[model samples]
Target: MLILTCPYCGVDAEETELAPGGEAHLKRFGPGASDEEFRDYLFARENPKGVHFERWRHAHGCGKWFHAARCTMTLEVFGTYPAQTTKPPKAIREAITAKRPGWTWREFE
Candidate 1:
């Protein structure tokens, strides 16, 4: 069972109690943006086999959204942080680095 600790309520909820919100740290495009940019924003996503960042909502708990870093293959969670953050927390990055050296995801390394 996959368990994620909600940063808002500090509750370690199971995946069944939460809702997956797709990829995190996406570059959103709004009005006046090119059609290609909009398409990429909506459809383009990274499905790496290694460490990945995702958005999760604590539906059955605090109802707040947060980000989680974990291995897609192993399901080994590095850490979780508030979704309001523009980037992963330093501690989370460090934890990922400790487990997977030379890891680089998007702009995070």
Candidate 2:
């Protein structure tokens, strides 16, 4: 089991306390965007063997959606930030500082 810190709740929570949402920072289609463009946006995922950015909802905490950089293979959580926060995190930075592949760093940007 992994522990994730809810940026809002400010406490480390079990992975059970959260629900995996989807790819993070998915771009929305603008007016007149083509079907192919929309389809790519909707269905594509990196599914990288290493670190990946994902969305998670604090289902048992603040009920807020947030960003988490996770390792696909190890299910390690690197860091967490509120989705509505002003600044996005530097993905590489979080991944590197994560003590283990499964520990989450709770820091606000």
Candidate 3:
């Protein structure tokens, strides 16, 4: 299994300790964007053969959200960071927190 180093937890964890959160840095459509544009925005993905950005969760440890650059074929973790790296929207934060045990927020400092 790939060893994931938590920037905050200061521990190298097994791949089972994390969860895949899909593509990262997806931008929300502006009011002026067309419906097709919005649909493409929501449905399209890079699926890069080389390096790709993916969201991950510390399922069994600090229980925080984060992103990682992983190789899809090899499942190698390139890096990881706290979910706050992008300062998630309120709704996103709520959704993540809800999935987490106790539904709490852990500030990444």
Candidate 4:
């Protein structure tokens, strides 16, 4: 069972208790943007086979959203952080690096 710690409430909740919000760190396109850009924003997503970042909501807990770094194939969770961060926190990044060296996600390394 996948378990994630809610950064807001500090509760370790199972995946069944949370709602997935999809890939994290997406670049959103708004009004005045080109049609292609907007279209890509709506449909384009990273479905990597290795380490991936995602958004999760503690639906049955704190009801707050957060970001999590985990391996898709192994389901090994590196860590979780608040959703307000623009990128993965230093500790999370380090943890991932320790496990999967040379790993890079989006612009984070």
Candidate 5:
């Protein structure tokens, strides 16, 4: 089972203990953006078979939303971080790099 540690409550929660909240760190296309941009944001998304970033809520615990880096193929968790920022924290990125070399998600280089 996929276990995630809550940054707020310090609870290591299993997959059922949390709620899947879909993709994380999505760039919002608003205001002056073209129609295609908004449509893509609403309809199109990355559904990779490998490394992916996602949002989750500690439903049975602190009830806080957080980001998690997970491997879709192997179900390996890289790490979890706060969801306030636009990308995964530096440490999480480094951890993923150490385990899975040449892995790149969007602009997180």
Candidate 6:
């Protein structure tokens, strides 16, 4: 089972203690956006086979949401970061690089 540490509550929670919040860093397409753009924002989500960034909530703990870098294929969590940013932090990126060299996710290197 995956273990996620909630930075706010300081709880090392199991997967059951958290809730998946889908892909993070999504650009909201609202009222003024074109129909196609709105539709794509709502439905066109990337489901890649490898590394991906997602949002997770510490539902059973602090109830705060955070970002996580994970591998879809292996279910391995690279690291977690604050949800306030649109891109993964440098430390998390370095950790992923150390574990899996040549890894690239979106605008992160």
lDDT on C-alpha atoms for all candidate structures:
0.92, 0.73, 0.67, 0.91, 0.89, 0.84
Cα error of candidate 2 at position 85, Å: 5.1
> What are the per-residue Cα lDDT tens digits for candidate 5 across 36-106?
99998898888999899999999999888999999999989888888896888899888988998997878
* Pairs of residues clashing in candidate 1: none
Candidate 4 TM-score over all chains jointly: 0.94
Residue pairs in collision within model 4:
none
Query: How does each model score on TM-score?
Result: 0.96, 0.75, 0.63, 0.94, 0.90, 0.88
What is the alpha-carbon RMSD of candidate 5 to the true structure?
Answer: 1.5
Which candidate wins on lDDT? 1
Give stretches of model 4 more than 4 Å off.
none
Q: Which residue pairs in candidate 5 have backbone atoms (N, alpha carbon, C) closer than 3 angstroms, thus clashing?
A: none
Model 2 TM-score (2 dp): 0.75
The window of 10 residues in a row where model 4 has the poorest summed lDDT is 100-109
TM-score of candidate 5 against the unseen true structure: 0.90
User: What residue runs in model 5 are displaced by over 4 Å at the alpha carbon?
Assistant: 31-33
Q: What's the best-to-worst order under TM-score?
A: 1, 4, 5, 6, 2, 3
Over 5-108, each residue of candidate 6 has an lDDT whose tens digit, in order, gives 77677777899999999998898876899999999889988788988888899998888999888888888887787788778888888888898889766774
lDDT per residue (tens digit) for residues 10-66 in model 3: 778787887767887666699999998899888987777644567777788888777
What local lDDT score does residue 95 receive in model 4, on the 0 to 100 scale? Answer: 90
Off by over 4 Å in 2: 85-88, 91-109
Identify the candidate with maximal TM-score.
1
* RMSD (Å) of each candidate, 1 decimal: 1.1, 5.6, 12.4, 1.2, 1.5, 1.6
Candidate 1 lDDT by residue in tens digits, 1-109: 8899999899989999999999999989888999999999999999999999999999999899999998989889999999999999999898988877898877754
